[model samples]
Target: MSLKSFGAKIFASYIRKKIDKWASQPEATQQKVFRELIEKGKNTKFGQDHDFKNIKTYKDFTQKVPIRDYEELRFYVDKMVAGEVDVLWPGKPLYYAKTSGTTSGAKYIPLTKDSMPAHINAARNAILCYIDETGNAKFVDGKMIFLQGSPEMDEKNGVKLGRLSGIVAHYVPAYLQKNRMPSWKTNCIEDWETKVDAIVEETIHEDMSVISGIPSWVQMYFERLQQKTGKKVGELFPNFNLFIYGGVHYEPYRAKFENLIGRRVASIELYPASEGFFAFQDKQNEKGMLLQLDSGMFYEFIRSDEFFEENPKRLTIGDVEKGVNYVIIVSTNAGLWGYNMGDTIQFTSLKPYRVIVSGRIKHYISAFGEHVIGKEVEEAMQEAMRSTKARISEFTVAPQITPENDELPYHEWFIEFEEEPENMDEFHRILEKTLQEQNSYYFDLIEGKILQPLKITTIPRGGFNHYMKSIGKLGGQFKLARLSNDRKIAEVLEENLRKYNK
Candidate 1:
């Protein structure tokens, strides 16, 4: 190897060693490490400027700071845009991660040096743990394809850093960096057509071991790959061993992926946001383990049941228990203190911190003007899937209000099935029964006949593609939204209803 490549190999080796050491630590030791980072953050310039200097412990830290969302961070971002040296973090942010601010409009989130490590380490651990679980470290011998957003640097900010994908590409050791598909310089998230073409062209002759990115985008790529190769993805990329996915739930898209790929691809669920990488799938059979970045942030959890209670209970990482749903809060080195990310999680176990993403706290659907949370929808869907004995490929639920019928509201489903059900009406009844039983409001409405019969729209193959195209969103990162159980569902459902009405 050349001298530069040799140096990169050494650096990559060092990173691997550090990651293994961190992952092998006992839960208690890991917590201590986290506490130390939180303490150090309290002393840093960011802490003082953000009112964290006086906070000595996690309790004091969370109490003094109020929970903040992306909108509040936008205030800090505006200052950064004006060239403020320090606002949220100690130094000027290297660049911002542009995220779809679904509810709050567009948001440019600060990505600082201290914060970058957390994101990188979380992602690295996800990969390492996947290898450990599958006993497939040798799969790394082949090239990995990360179907990600373009790396074009934001010219307006006078920042050289590309989006998160680009920024991560730059930080990876040079040797492995060269192995990246569609070289960073050429990939642009906005230029989807060209980027996708480039990715397909570049990987045509390469041996692929792992593929990672948003499931929607990866699915799109595989569809294109099928057309181009005239062969399924399995035939074209037989060596691919793992599928690392995040950004959205995989349940809806799982079977489709398995069908296209022709083998069971090991999956790793990653929790990444523009702000930082928070958790990842740590074991093979178990759900994702919340690997606390004890060195990056102090963690807190607000019990899901108590989230709206008169005096809701908030628990530290130390206080979390098995099987309870919680909203994750964090105080990170990058200057975010007591920030609530709005994602809901349920602990599978307490000993090792295993948790499954329940849903977004803010994202839910209830059409009868009753609150229907993500957990409710998940349970109802699970029951529906079981009752019908039908494998759901993808689905989204919304409330429909019939015109001229003021008192009647109905639930509408846009469903993609693995195989056509023998009796469509029976399938709908099973789903309706499941929903009514799972959600009390639906049950009451159905009994009173105040609610219209549930409507079902069976989508044609590639229906998600049409949906993604309609929104001008690339399939890779977008998710099917279960809009509020009220009028919001009507707006979201309208588009899908129009597309899949047949």
Candidate 2:
């Protein structure tokens, strides 16, 4: 082995020890993390504004700082954007990670000096931990290609704004950048289609070992690669073994990905957003990610079901129970305090604090008393696909609660298919059966005749993509919400279908 590769392995060993050490004392590490954040930022403007110095305990801290959403926190973030020092954090943030709003306006979340390493190191350790657990590190010697966002960042009052992945790209280790696929220029292309073309041209024959991205965008890249190479991805890059994914659930796209690659590759799931790198898969046999307890972020959980309660119970690490859905609230080094990041998670295990991404707090269908989460919908799609052997390109579900005239209220699905099943009725039957089995409320509604069966509409080719482009949310960091208890997204899908039919 080369000296450089040997050096990489040695450094990875050090990070693995750090991960394992924290795993042994999950709660203690979490407490230390919380205390450290308070200690470090207690003198900052936000800290002083919230009386952080007087806050002696978690209970005291929560009592002092109320939970806030992005809009509520915007005043402080805007001041930071306007070159105000010590407004949120102690100083100006290094960059603002802009989120691609699905149906709403964009948000600029901050990335600070202290917060940057928490994000980068967590990702680095995720891979190192995977290698430690599985004894699979061949990928480390080859390319680690991540389908990242544009490197082009817009500056507002001396603050840089770009997608979190693009911001992350700037922090790629010096060793990996030598083998990271596609030039910075190609990744900076704003057009998704154009970018895919350039990426295909750039990395068609490079020695790729690992690939990472949101499933939809990466699928586009894989499809383009197949068309160009006239071979399965596995055939083109035999060493390709690891896939690290976040942003959306991978179950619905599982079969399609497997088919494209010609085989199943080992995978890891991550729970990262513009807020911070919250968690990543740490165990090969485990279902959930080991939460990052020492990542300079303090996590609080509010029962997901009771998120809108007049004064919802805020639970810390010690109070969180397993198997319950909770909306994640974060206090970060980037100056966010008791902020609701909007993502909902459920603890699959408590001893080591492993969690699964249940759904977005905003993305669920419960209009007819059927509280179907993103995970459930993804599972139903996966089950139906498995049973009927159909594959979908992309899909979204919405509650059609206020039906016009004689139509009964029901859930509606707008789907784009790579290959449609020959028997659509069978596909629906299997999907509906799985959903009913998964969600008791929906089953009860159907049995009581209070709601009709679910509705499925086949979107025309490129219809969803057309809608995305029309709304200026065409690619990178844009994840079409999988479920909503509203008709806004469903209506747009219907409109796109109509336009395509014409």
Model 1, span 262-330: residue lDDT tens:
767778888787666777877777766665545476677898657767657667766777776688877
lDDT string, candidate 2, 329-409, tens digits: 999988888999888999998878899998989889888667889888888899889888898889999888678997888
Residue pairs whose backbone atoms clash in candidate 2? none
| Shift in Å, residue 277, candidate 2 | 0.3
For each candidate in turn, the TM-score is 0.84, 0.96
**Model 1 alpha-carbon miss at residue 390, Å:** 5.1
Q: Candidate 1: lDDT of 124?
A: 71
Q: What is the lDDT of residue 230 in candidate 2?
A: 89
For model 2, what is the error of residue 361's alpha carbon versus the real structure, in angstroms, after optimal superposition? 1.0
